[model samples]
Target: MSRQAIGKANCFHDKGHHADCTLSSYPYMAAFGIIQIILSQIPNFHKLSFLSIMAAVMSFTYATIGIGLAMATVAGGKVGKTNISGTVVEVDVTATQKIWRSFQAVGDIAFAYAYATVLIEIQDTLKSSPAENKSMKRASLLGVSTTTFFYILCGCFGYAAFGNKAPGDFLTDFGFYEPFWLIDFANACIAFHLIGAYQVFAQPIFQFVEKRCNRNWPDNKFITSEYSVNVPFLGKFNISIFRLVWRTAYVVITTVVAMIFPFFNAILGLIGAASFWPLTVYFPVEMNIAQTKVKKYSPRWIGLKVLCWVCLIVSLLAAAGSIAGLISSVKTYKPFRTIHE
Candidate 1:
């Protein structure tokens, strides 16, 4: 997505808005994978404070810019065609498309609000000065509320501005043009944020794999060894052969998959469907119940179980929708050749 943004901005700047600005993103994608490989050496999530802070700021900046632009478009009375519900079947949509799209929307929205996958990881870093649970509660409340508020603003305004014709990715999908520089700047911000965001998400998985390997083979020198090399200002840098190999391969594989699919929304929806319920809902809920010693089949337990069932149904529907979307995209897309050819 970040690569797409950069390519889109450059294309729009060089070619005119009306020109054929479709991008072949292989080069940019490769470039990104290489950069991620280098950034993967940043050790662990605890050391990612700078990247996390940058990602947060950039996210807010781009989101605000997108919302402002959408509102401006609506205010200027440049709104595109809109329908109260789904797009008109006779005009551009079919009944199947509508049903699938509705399902897709559910998945997309689920994915959008799914941010607690790293909740425990975050709480692990909190200071003990304040009660951890209280601080965590306050932080989660503010974070979730603010994020939802901005998300709603973005969705509502973007829809009002572009109506049924709204681009899937407003910032990079030719949705805005007149203020090309601002659009470029927003895209740049997205790239920067994603660069950091990718590491934030990937580092945990890296550590998990490395730690497991070390635990499973404590005597394997290749897997257990950590060589330190002295650096100028940063001091000694620890290099692990296993980590270097595993992380590099992981990044490469994911990069290739992204290159092959290149359908961001569908892929994201699928991932959300696969991980959201398990990582965000099931484990946490179960852990809470166990911690509080809630009796089985009691009111609280039943409520939590019902919630889990509901979320499971949602995840299943989302998975179906995402699979349908991917199939649809594959029929239209020519991997790496063009976006929608």
Candidate 2:
């Protein structure tokens, strides 16, 4: 939600008015948050298949558009041996900075492809079948492969076109003198896709919180009929009042945080650093090692555990660097300092 809000805010950046500028993200965040909450309140998770399709379509459309734009730039004779000046590009790099950036790149990769975070839930959405494992394996393989290809393709083309002039966000790297309709379309697609993605991720968190709240304040089956709705076309549906309240509150809290700290890269880096190792690397390896009963200190066990240890150390360093970077950003931060800024 925070990242989405920040992205939306970038759409209308005004540099002169620095203070209270990022307040623009608040309305956008609230609007999308409402959409997410409503969609998440759907009776069953499986019913979100339509949303998933929309997410996929929107994502693919924007990705294709972005790639097309990059290729067009390259074909238009924009890229050259001479680097473009006055662009937000990273041309020079020292060894120390490169090392820090490698750690930063880990976080960016984690953010881009953090499938492990919701793999279990996504698998659960699949229909029960004898070949469920096979089906899921094939799906995962194809999805990851396709996404990876696109990622690499886009990166290669984008770098080729912009060279050292690429900004942090490739979309915004399209110079601003001309308000490209394609850029607007791309941002809209991104925002629309995020509406679905937010619900997919937030639904699980909502369910977890609802469960905890239920344990604390058990729902009374005998509650007033107002909580139960009998729509003419939609049949009777029971709405958990407490569930609605808490989820709505959660959306508000996240929105406020997004507005207060509109640093998208920093927050993403932080989340990636925090979740990359535990959710993606350590848990899976440890689970496999335990299931296989790998002998303690054996080469196999050591090798398996070595990845986890390496991930832990690297992720910690990344997280520390991310935090330091975020602090520095905060210290020098100005609100709505133009899109390129």
Q: Write the per-residue lDDT of candidate 2 for residues 5-73, one digit (tens) a residue.
A: 334345445332232333344566667767766766675556777888898898898788778877887
Which stretches in model 1 have alpha-carbon errors above 4 Å? 3-7, 10-15
Put down candidate 1 lDDT per residue, 1-341, tens digits, no spaces. Answer: 55566666677678876667666778888988999999998878888899899999999999999999999999999998988884787676788877776677778877766767566677888899797899999998998899999999998999999988888888877788758778878888888898998997788788888889888999999998889989799999999888888999999999999899988888888887888898888988999999999999999999999999999999998889889999998897777686642
Model 2 C-alpha RMSD vs. true structure (Å) is 5.1
**58: Cα error in model 2, Å:** 1.3
Candidate 1 lDDT (Cα, whole model)?
A: 0.85
